[model samples]
Target chain A: MTRVGDVLARCRAEGRAALIGYLPVGYPDVPGSIEAMTAMVEAGVDIVEVGVPYSDPLMDGPVIQYAVETALAGGTRVDDVFTATAAVRDAGAPALVMTYWNLVMRRGVETFASDLAAGGGSGLITPDLIPDEAGDWIASSESHGLDRVFLVAPSSTSERLTRATSACRGFVYAASTMGVTGTRTSVGSAAEGLVARTRAVTDVPVCVGLGVSNGEQAADVARFADGVIVGSALVRCLTEAPTRADGIRALTDLTRELAEGVRARRSTPGGAPGGASGMVASA
Target chain B: MTTPGRFGDFGGRYVPEALIPALEQLDEVRRKAMIDPEFVGELERLHRTYTGRPSILTEVPRFAEHAGGARVILKREDLNHTGSHKINNVLGQALLTKRMGKKRIIAETGAGQHGVAAATAAALLGLDCVVYMGKVDTERQALNVARMRLLGAEVVAVENGSQTLKDAVNEALRDWVANVDDTHYVLGTVTGPHPFPEMVRDFHRVIGIEARAQVLDLVGRLPDVVLACVGGGSNAMGIFHRFLDDTGVRLVGLEAGGAGVTTGRHAARFSAGERGVLHGAFTYVMQDVDGQTVESHSVSAGLDYPSVGPEHSYLLDIGRAEYRPITDVDAMEAFRLLCRTEGIIPAIESAHALAGAIDVGRELGPEAVLLVNLSGRGDKDVHTAAQWFGLLDDAALQSAGAIASADATGVSSLTDGVQV
Candidate 1:
């Protein structure tokens, strides 16, 4: 499996932000979700974050929550996440598990990390777990050689950004907005400043997530970000599709557009390929 | 401050990163307010004047007969303004909102007690208030919706997830995250992130303190057992905190057992829950083997949550408190008994505790002294009770069905001639 850091570095080398697409494992159904995510990769998603659906997705907005609820109702299990991850990776994108912390803690951090690694996962995107409280996870990720990606939000202070990026191994997930994940008309105005603040503190790539739906928004974020993450929009594509084939088609089409969007700003004079500057700032 | 976000293996800030600074800020302010005499003084004065604090402990000989002849003492939190123990937590948090210089408060409620309390606090403090109530809860507790509007709170009926307290909390949290700059999420339970469980419990600690002294003063000794219904466990923690050191006072929490634990439809978390996280804390959550939270059922909307408070989980793990499940049938019977014997229309949530007290009294016989936290009045639940007991007249039944239909269609109208 491609390491998350390698994926980000490759994106930087190519002078384009990585297109990160999210879909919950077992959404619609286990096999179908895997197929859809694999299609996303085939269409140009650089990294795929397979959400392991939880009962209560507190941080999720209506779109992701609906997908997760459907996935949970369809009996999505922890093992299915690994299967989806491996499939997405096999389809050529590094797969990361984006899940609430409870699932990892319940499965035991070390065991979860090892299982994820075995399943071809390159990293984890923990939306809720902060670095200050991630001692065990940091240890587990290091031992398993899996990237530990933590979230930094618009509400984060510079001190918090420093703390978060310090523990990050792959890239820092920058939540563009303060609310739960959803597609909004306008990306939060605070996103650019937050990315700059986070970039000033670490060499880890900074990826902005939350509210980047269409290709245009993806391109807009890609100009300032090392990666642009799209979750609710992709999930919405699957949810709104009339059938499995249609869902996969819609997902791939959107992924292709987002790919173009990311690549569109690559040669722009101000759009630099530099990731976060200091490699060992947190250490 | 020692362990800001933990109760043993449970309780931590398991929220998205966006809320971390807010939680930290809230926690810091809470720490300061905890020691600041002025904050304490304001809270105390409000409790005395507005909330009718020092709620008396009334010994019920008549109700004791139903409790197998044990001396049953009641902590009258029902007499508090807004008619429940929820006022205790809301008033305290409202004060905190002021100290934080916030001008608005947002809260979520199930049966609407907390929403009403929050609305009351907001009204008194001249702050804007918004309450998120599940569509189902707003229908069932329509009076509370009206009451909140009267108190100048915008009651937004949430139509997500299970359409209950859990969903309301989700919406409220979303709102808080989006509006964190000037708004305080007046979380209505002893759950959520770091300071919430600790802070809400502290606000309610007055219950146990007052009841302990009042019980001792009236009965000449501490009760053998303290009983309180555990929904999110604020009241149980409120009454249980002061008696934790008593050693002899067996703290018992009664959970809503809708049908029964065996039927897989109850809210008895400790009985049938697995260790999982929900609503930001690692506690005993009623979840499936795959870790998806299962919807819990209860006759009482307040107790229909799938997870317990983190502190309750810790206490249960350490064997400091015993949790028991009481079925709807038993609880309703207790509810009627409280009304018939003691002239008290107790909330069904509180009746669950009365049911437990009955069992405890039976086990220990007449010598056992029990103090039950009467958490709230049954005013909000009267419509539910009327339907449950088949007490609704023909016109009332039709309107009740209409209300149910309205709730299903996302349209609620309390002024449609359906009298309580």
Candidate 2:
């Protein structure tokens, strides 16, 4: 019943950053996916983003794209993404739906948000939709209990950055660079700078995505970010690990690993945590 | 038919395990399609009715005069619908996609020729299409974006690294990964995971098949040499594929040397680059130590690429064909020579082949007949050609721009050997 920001605030109060992991709804198989989502929650994921498969995902890197293909071929569709997320809702596990605008647009913004909320999705991340251009979807999403988030990259101008921050609802997505999501050992310091600039624009949570490829990188990113979203690495593990179960286990463990990483350094010299309760950005 | 994956180590499939099954399935698809009566009949129908098959083979006597009197024949693929031999492969692949039960198609294109052709095929097939072009190329070829849109393809301008043809390929592959269940990637050139190079070449071999028979019929004997320009080398493959078994035909593949072998701004895969994996299969690639593909530059945008088709590598090693270079200056001269001497303006990419033939023709003497594929009309190069010839700055060409039939792709479409 709590909002995505509420869970993030609870994590901040506990001196830990939210760790969001994304997994295709029917990856490996339906049962395996359910088990994976459950495993991710048990392993320490504060939030999960269940993807709705689309015929085209132009923004994804090779790893996540392949996961989408595998998942779709295994029969994962938009309804399944919500169906799979129902368990997360029933168990009180915090989750959101990560997908392309094409899939979201097809489902209709209001229907998508309400369906996501009904299935226990606490937030919505439309990586392709810039808020400045979002007229109807932004308004409808807020009315339906879904927090509409936007991604701003290092190349985003300060003007656009301000507009993006104002338009965002749940958390501001701070991309490390103009590139697609992929594995990297560490987040660039530019990411830290961008996070700070976004923080100045709004009190809403900012999730630094892209290049937060591993637990250590996530820990490093959480030093300045409210949350960290790991996409390609989790998808890569889901597809490449020796066994389907091992892959799921590895992905689920990433959330806990990243969570404990930032939690371990809460008392360090740097600003340890930012509060969860705040006015979500209102445009 | 017993050919192994290795092109004596030059054309082997060096992909990861995850891609092998897909590659093999594609190769099988190719094998079955070749022998399937219905498939063959459908292809023939498209070739004859749709693409205007058996495209003309012309004899260039004036250009041939410089050649020790060696007879020269030009296979006029420029005369094909939508222009360029790129149409042949894209149509074949689009047809195959429909056969495979896929409803959506995706492709990567540079210089707009392949993109236009792919979009045209998608439109005709009534399939949804997405074209990923590099942002740089999209800017340079804005006309192509409009053309693709007219064909009902959503043109996505990829703002990724370098924003050239290679980046477009990477983007298309990523799209394929995400939508593999319902989408078929119509790879433009003879690159990417196996079967594509082989498949595209097979689709285009009709050029060589037509040229060979025409040469033997008209000249009463096989020509001493055959020449075509090489970028991804589909044009070269189109004219050379059938000649692979012909030992008497001297096969010459001309690559862009840019300025010279040492100048480094050229698309000479065999002459300058090493074998590497690009798109999908292993081929001659222009790359640095870290295995990153290097940027290749040439006066011809179509030839401005870093790799050659894997099949070309196989042909090179098996001693069936030879790849050499034609500098930018030399290609332009050949472009002018064909225009002035024969009154036919040829695509700058095909002009590389003309430059190569001019070099070897003089040595071969008057009796030799060399088949050069006039792959496309040179209208697309009018602006660049004007700059190269200093037409805008030079008073002579500027005055004759309208009289020369070398204005842009449109004017060239009205000239000799042009099928407008």
Candidate 3:
């Protein structure tokens, strides 16, 4: 099994934060998407989370909602998402998927998990599917050799902490705020608290998403968690640049910027020495 | 009795921590502004001049003649601007949004009429509008898309699960969560957490308030029955409000039976849905026993939701009004019958009430005066109706749409007033 500690060690040794970018399943056209993913890999991407658009994306803001609509209108299906990931796999990049439980539930978790595993997907991140209500999914996904990435918010209870750790395989996603996914100018103090609380529950790696915007925010967040997941900022990357190449270039540039920021702090002698950088240096 | 504004044990504000301060702020300012002389005056002026309120009290005698000779009167909201009672609520909510000094409006729409109305109001007030609709509904109601864009609104099609009204409500709730500080969420129907149903009903109450007086003036008596369609129940609630306390006015609420309520194919929440909290408060919800919401359907896209407002639930429980269902076939039949009899095309959603009135009239017989609310005109249903009845090829439906107008006798006919 690919353990959380190992992924964390490898990420630290590389001196890079995991760059997770989400693209709508059939957005900018599906075949065009394969080319884009390959481009993103060549541009130095770490991980990718493909969003399967649903008709009721209860958590998305307008920007992502528009993107999902555009993609679904193009007839993006779960199979299409799997097919779309072929480019990521052929390009040899690890990929995760972010979608609502309803889609997976409707498709039957066992079938979806197997299909996703067969399609070369790595992990799953569902913000609303609670660990308590997700037993069937956890068993099915784990049975199919998939990582069930559970989310823990700042408002999560101790019971939630226990449930989240036991149900998850990959790093537990720690939401930094009380609300839905959105942008904020700075990292909250509660971010550190949530990490500390989750650290007490189990030995699994913890990652934060939903508020980090730039290299500085990622750099700030990298100080505490295993890795940082950036979405809206990356989606913004797609809209900012005129072409897919420019979009890939933007993500690659930010990935490198954040990687360097994490590396500097990791390499400093005895400054904070628990990560892979210290192990490599000591060896 | 029962504090006037409540709906069953389920209609109070059960909001999150973040929404409290803003809601309380709205409460303090809303009551004062709604009751102010200037505000009321402007609202009335717009209601009269722009919307053509004091909307007509119509009599359907041929239909009435069939109904054991009962006198059937219609409250003609279908003649209002934009062709539905949705205009009545949107205008009021829009004015309140403006007075709050907000610059942007966000709403969730299903069939797109409410989105059109909200967009129209935002355009009139020069406010930026963002209407989130389920992607499926967007495809289904494309003409409404053109209408909204012409009004200068941004239409964000949501591709969430089921791609229906409930999902649109969820997306709109998510938007309100992120932008509660600077934006106003103009909820179309009256089913969200709190104050939405109450606030929307207050705006629509003008319909019932006006009709009560008009019916008395015209007929010299109160109606034996007052009826309207119930989707989110805003129109029904609005039309039912003044009659809530009237002992003699028998208010009836009609819900869409879709294929049939028993077959689980309808959007008649009050008939099949149970009491549960959805959106923000407890109300009649189309949820499974496990509590997840189920998808609802109706021939009328506007009424196609799995839940209804809390206040309507309260009304049903307290027996203040009666809730019944009208199937798609029934509503369509009423749609064709009304057009041939009265020269008016009603919205499919509103046609549900027209269906109820037809039944109620037959049962009541001669000497019974019933008021059926024509909640909206039916231009949108022309395409759907044409397809259903083979009018697409029959060449009978698309005849310049010039049906014989029912004269002052409350009945007109091309074929001796015998539709059957």
Candidate 4:
């Protein structure tokens, strides 16, 4: 099993969902972002998704887009992604790079995989690179011992869902809505259905993202998903903060709240265990 | 023919999973519509009755003087209903949107030509239309913006990234992703994922088809060369597709070179770009070493994009077509020449083709029959053109007036004095 799988398994054993947090690698600057991610881990984030700021982030909303523009304006490079990943790994969590396909393709898939592996990254969460166009990445991730996490949306056909789940190495990323990433007032009702559909296809842990921002939302997704992923809300902590310390403090507070929220499902009977393992045994 | 959704190694659906089913649905609908007689007849009727298809072919002998006496024929797509060839694809897509039972349509534009065309089609069909244009383009092409609003379409000025065509496309895709169930993204050009490149190209193939038949009827032969400006390559693909089988006819695409390719401030993707993915298709994209899209500059907003259509990249690889850069200065000069000599105010995007024709005409010399796709009219570009040639400045306008009056007096000395 991959490091991400191990974390999910541990969370399942603990009767809770894993808390996965995301921050672009160079939002405030390289070191500041790495510090923020490390703080997230310290505050109880089980997994760290190091976002690679891209020029055109199509699936991103205003919050993440603003953070990305700030990161890019600071001259963030691909090398900084690895640097932040390594720092997150050192801080005690499996780090995965969430990036657009062009950056990976530009760096050469095999080369990017090897470098990520060297930096102690566990997997990748490709927002744009679907399984239909992931041949090179699939082979390269396998050869380099890095997990490839592809996303499934509410719109995915059954055939596409099977293909995507069968190709996944770490876990399946189930986007909570049919929209770009943002902190919505309410996560879409479609997330639970998509997770269930994905579970029917594969035993891979299905993580829910796109709108899980606060504690209550985390608890809500934790009822069905194997992991709860938060991005824009966590990034907003840094974006709205007046200083680096305030950003780090806000990130820590949110991470703790989310971590507690995921565990809040533990006391509720049949809440968290109904995810990957339970679904497979019942099938 | 080559592979479904592929032109060589370039075209494919490289997008979010949410868009895959939408693309597949679009492809299926496009295929059925292409083969459906009723659908084809409806679109054709719309073209004949509405868009003014078989846009006339005009020969510019006076303009040919700058081209070393070569004969230049223009495929006047500018005379179409919305004042550009963009009407062809927008009308086709709008018809398809209705067929899909969609109630609304979204689109992205650079110079606002496609937006205007889409707005026009949507108004005719009673579908809600929203157009995303770069903030910079909305200001520069404010007339087209107003035209779209007047046509009952909402115009959104995208404010991210370079604030040009590329960013507008990004915003449009985001909207499509969220509203895919009810809205059809009437993509403006032959870029984007599968089906889009092929489908948009098919919608525009009438340009070459008509121009070819017209040349035969007028010049008694197919032209030796076909030329069109390559923005997202809709018009180029439109005029180049039918002539692909004609081995004797050469296809050349002129790309915008804002300053010069070497200056790193131009949109000449084929001139300096490498193989990369952008706006959903794997094609030639102008990007930094880390694969971040670089800003593409062009005086003409239509051609100011960081990437070209995927088929252009494939055609370049196989050498079936040739692409060259035309600097802003050269394009504007051609723009002035066409206005003065042919009474044609060509779009700046189309003027890139005119600039290229001048060079090719000079090279091929007098007997060569060159067909250039006059993709759109210059009505939307009056502001930019005025600023470009300093006509907007009172001092420069007065100086030009003085030079004109001095030249009218038939006194070279007085003209030089006016310049001094």
The most accurate candidate by DockQ is 4
> How much lDDT does each candidate structure score?
0.87, 0.74, 0.72, 0.90
- Candidate 4 regions with alpha-carbon error over 4 angstroms: A266-272, A275-283, B1-3, B393-420
- Arranged by lDDT, best first: 4, 1, 2, 3
**Of the true contacts between chains A and B, what fraction does model 3 have?**
0.17
**lDDT per residue as tens, model 1, A1-283:** 2378778777777778899999999889999888888788889999998898886777888888888878877777888999888888788888988988878877878889999999999989998787766888898888888888899988898888898889888889999988888999989779988988888887788899999999899888988888999999999889999987888888889999999999887443643554435332331
**Which numbered prediction scores highest in TM-score against the true structure?**
1
User: In order, what DockQ does each candidate have?
Assistant: 0.56, 0.03, 0.11, 0.60
Docking class for model 2 is incorrect
Docking class of 3: incorrect
Report the lDDT tens digits of candidate 4 across residue range B27-67: 99999999999999999999999999879999999999999
Superior by DockQ: candidate 3 or candidate 4: 4
True contacts kept of 2: 0.03
Candidate 1's C-alpha runs over 4 A off are A266-271, A274-283, B1-3, B400-420
Tens digits of per-residue lDDT, candidate 2, B271-345, equal 878766565556788865424456787887778778888878888887888989999999999999889889888
What are the runs in model 3 whose C-alpha is more than 4 Å off? Answer: A1-57, A60-179, A182-209, A212-283, B1-6, B13-18, B394-420
